[model samples]
Target chain A: MTTYYTKSHEWIRLDGEEATVGITAHASEELGELVFVEAKDEGTEVAAGDTAAVVESVKAASDIYAPVAGTLSGFNTKLSDEPTLVGSDAEGEGWIYKMTVSNPDDLKGLLTAEQYKSL
Target chain B: MSDTLHQTPLHALNLELGAKMVPFAGYEMPIQYKAGLMAEHLHTRSSAGLFDVSHMGQLRIAAKSGDVRDAALALETLIPADYAALGVHRQRYGLLTNDEGGIRDDLMVANMGQDLFVVVNASCKHQDADLIEKALGDRCIVTRHFDRALIALQGPEAQNALTSLCPAAADMKFMDAIETELAGVSVTLSRSGYTGEDGYEIGIAAKDAETVARALLAQPQILPIGLGARDSLRLEAGLCLYGNDIDPTTTPIEASLAWAIQKARREGGSREGGYPGADIVLRQAREGVSRKRVGLMAEGRAPVRAGAKLFADAEGTKEIGVVTSGAFGPTVNAPVAMGYVATEFADVDTALFAELRGKFVPVHVRAMPFVAPGFKR
Candidate 1:
């Protein structure tokens, strides 16, 4: 499994054709406390840079873009009941959704952990 | 973003408390701290929360005649509130209206017997000062207090925390103001705040602001809060933010603030129709406006934030209103918002739809002050 990061602060863990996505810790910290989270329904196909989800904090709302073109297979429904988990454990249990990639080659263009940290 | 951004007297103390700094209204202020907005908001409701609101502008208005009533009567020409009738040591909420009956700014005016103490929004302070000076300069002295710093101690436990430092604070009712000493420092204390909580807004010398703030924070019941919580608390209270909820495009009658304009200033009263935009404001008071601001209760968890257009139907064909301020209320345990809509749709429980992220979501028109105020009065 390899973790890939995007300039917009979304991170994806890729394994074979399956992938899990969530916001980076830096992004979570910037967003402060999360009050609500919503994403496209399961099986919704989205292209790279398209808005797939939204996260709201007490002060403002922000869009979570799709990291790569893929069909959303599942969502982290727990966020619907416990949105603060995104602020507490954004990288793990707070993962927003799961998807099946249409093209694995798209992963090669994302930044590594080192490059994302420098960014 | 620029080095030119102003820093409050408590800026260094905010950094020491692990605050997340952000630029707002030409000042570098704390948006939240380690506890975040939720914790700070809840704490302010249950206990005491200390807030640094130093960026707001404060000034003194006094007539050359040496009587506060003269100044208040003179100021009545600028705002719609009844200031001449306001008792000494008492404060009233006021609005600065333009010739078109639109709100230029909303402010608090405290009658200090010999002079009137006023506070205005930070973003419009310079313009407001110039307006007052230019309008009333011949009859009154409008002295801007650039050397002052303001702080608020809010919540149910606010009185308890404050009386420990200034014992006389316990005797004050809501909207009462007093020039007193706190921790051996001279400060003007007002038993009023933007939050619906029972609290006090203290104005101190810029040099002594940090000392008084630290003294208040030293109380076990008081925790330092930031602007993020302040905003949520005010939204829950249904109070208007000058630039956001009420602007130059909004009027007192249209914003559901008619109550703030005392009967003495209305038509048929002793002093009638002298303020700016009096013709439109008074006529609206009698005839009603085409659109009016109302509280919005959005269905579901997602917040229907400001800039969301409201419609009469979910299909998003006919637009009726637009949200001014919206946020997730931690105390209310739901998303709450304020917006303007057609007068017919402004009734309580009227169903409206808000377009959020290209999808129209259900919202209901609701009465404001989502949470009841905890004022001592």
Candidate 2:
């Protein structure tokens, strides 16, 4: 599996035709505490840059954008009861959702970890 | 974003404590610390939290001839509250009104021994000071306390922490103010605060502010809270923020602050119709306003925010009102908000919808003070 990052702060790890997605640790830290999370329903089709999720802290609410065009396969339901997971381990157990890649070529638009860090 | 933002006396202390600094009211102030907004908010409710409110303006309104009643009467011409009936050492919430029946600002006025101590919003301090000077200059002397700093210690354990420093603070009830010494520093301490908690607002000389703040934080029950938690706390308390909840376009009656106006200023009273906009305000108090401010509870976990439009139907076709302040209440464990809606729809249990992210979320009208105030009174 190889991982790619987006400038919007989402990170995706591709495993064959499926991918796991979550926000970067830096993004979670900047958002402070997580009080609520809303993910797109399973099986919903989304395009790149579409708002697929929302995360709310005590101070403000932010939208999490889809990194690439895909069909959402599933989402982590644990976030409904324990949103703080996003703040505790954003890049691990805090994974927001899994999706089936609609077009493998969509990976070309993502940045490598090194390139994302430079931006 | 401006490099010229003013810094409070505790600016260095905040940075040292790992606070996220942001610009507010022309000052670089802390939005939250390392513990984050949620923890900071809950901590203040369970124990005590110290806040830097030095950016607010404090002023002394004194009569040149040394008569306190004369000074109070002079101020009565500008606001609708009955300052003359305000007992000594007691504070009253007041509103500065324009001649057109609009609100200029909301403030706290305390009757000290020989003068009136006034605290105004940070953003409206300069304008308020100028208005007071221009209107009442001949009758009273208005002295702005530009070199003073104000700090608030709020929570259930606030009294315990404050009384430890000044034992006499224990004698004060809510809204009481007294001049006393705290750790050898002369200060005016008031048993009043924006947070709906038992707390004290201490006004001290700017030079001694840092020392006093450090002493308060040294108490085991007290932690430094930032603006983020302070905002959520006040919102849950159902208190209004000046610019957001009550602005120049809002009237006291329309804002559901009719309780702040005593009977002496209303119709059938001896001093009726003396203050600016008294005619319109008094009429509204009797006839009622077309719109009123009310509390709202979101049906789901998603937090609704300010500027969210309101609708009467779930279809979200007819816009009825707009939210002014909204946040996730740490105490209620749900999303709460305050907004202005048509008077007919302001009743408790009224069904409404708040448009968030292009979708309407179900909301119900509810009574304010989402969490019961733990006032010492």
Candidate 3:
């Protein structure tokens, strides 16, 4: 198992062909109290790096991009009613979506958990 | 961040409390605290939120001779509201307009005695003072209460939280004001505020303002709120800030504040006091304006923001209005915004669309005050 991060601040934890994706804690803190989170539909195919979600706060609006090329399998539907869960636990309970990693090699080029921490 | 920004007496206290500071009206003021905007905003609606509003200028206006109300009447000629009708110890919201009928600033006038009281706001205080001075002539005197610092203790906990600081304050009614001592400082306490809650705006002596603020913030419910939460909280309460909601380009009638107009002024039974754009004002009261400010409740969780274009959702691309104030309303726990739309779109069920990042967000034209106001009055 390995974790990868995008420059846009999204993270993907890859396990074979399956990957779990969510925004970095840094992104959530910067966004302030999360008021709304809009994730892509399940099975939505994206051409890697596409804006996959919208994250809103009391003060700002931001787009979350797809870190690795894949089809979104499902989303954390709990986000609609409890967006602050992202602020509370961005890495675990706050995971945004699960996807099938179309190209597992995409993970190698992304930032490691240690490298992402330095940011 | 601007070096030109002013600092309130409790500026250091706000920093000490880990507040998020922001520039507001040339002043470095706190917008929220470590609890952040949402918690502070929700707390203000449910409990109480202490705000350091010392950056706002508090001043006194009086007539050296006759009743200040009579003098205020003469001064009212320069404003859109009928000031002479205000009861002593009460307060009313008002605006200063130019010859074009556009608002110069929105302000609050508290009747201290028959002839004297305080008026306050940020950025517009100086100009507001000058306008009042120019209109008074020999009839009244306007003096700056620069020796004082203004603090707003707003919300349900306000009455109780203030009791420890000023015991006499508990007896005050909404919009009612009285001179009292708090934190060993003589202060003019007014049961008024911008957050649409039962609160008091305390004008403490400059030297003692920090002491009073410290004493108020000592309580658990009294979190130090800054400018960011101040904006969202007021939006939730459906209160208007001068710059975003009303400005030089807007008018009282257009702003939907015609209630501030004195009934006598509309009747024309008394002497007609001269003021800028009085003719157009009376005419507006008789008929109505083409546009009006109304509340908007979105169909989804995506909140409409200020400057978002408003269009008829069904009619397609026809631009009708634009949002002036907006946010996810903390009190109502939903997104709400206020904007000016054509009179035809001001009804409760009028369907509208807010263009956000190219997406047309569905909206409905609702009444003002997205949430209920808890002013003591």
| iRMSD per prediction, in order | 0.7, 0.9, 1.0
* CAPRI class assigned to model 1: high
Task: Output the better candidate (1/3) by DockQ.
Answer: 1
Candidate 3 residues A13-103, lDDT tens each? 9877888999989888767898888877888887678977888887667888888888988788899989999999998899888888889
Worst 10 residues of 3 chain B by lDDT: B265-274
Q: Please list the C-alpha lDDT of all candidates, in the order they appear.
A: 0.93, 0.90, 0.81
* Total backbone clashes of candidate 2, pairs 3 or more residues apart or in separate chains: 0
Per-residue lDDT over B1-377 for candidate 2, one digit per residue giving the tens place of the 0 to 100 score: 57799888788888988899999999999999888888889999999999998899999999998988889889989988889888889888999998877789999999998999999999999999999999999989999996689999999999899888899989999999888999889999999998899899999998999889888989999999999999999999999999999987888999999888788887887677687788888888889999999999999888889999999999899888999999888888999999999998999999999998878999999998999998877
- The residue pairs found clashing in candidate 2 are none
Best by TM-score: 1
Residue A82 error, candidate 3, Å: 2.2
- Candidate 3 error regions (>4 Å): A6-8, A15-19, A40-50, A66-74, A97-110, B64-67, B137-139, B267-273
Predicted chain A of model 2: TM-score relative to the true chain A? 0.95
Preferred candidate (lDDT higher): 1 or 2: 1
Task: Considering the two chains of model 3, state its CAPRI-style docking category.
Answer: medium
In candidate 2, position B199 carries an lDDT of 93
**Chain A structural similarity (TM-score) per candidate?**
0.97, 0.95, 0.93
lDDT by residue for model 3 over B273-325, one digit each (tens)? 25677677667767888889998988878788889999986444899999998
**Residue B110 displacement (Å), model 1:** 0.4
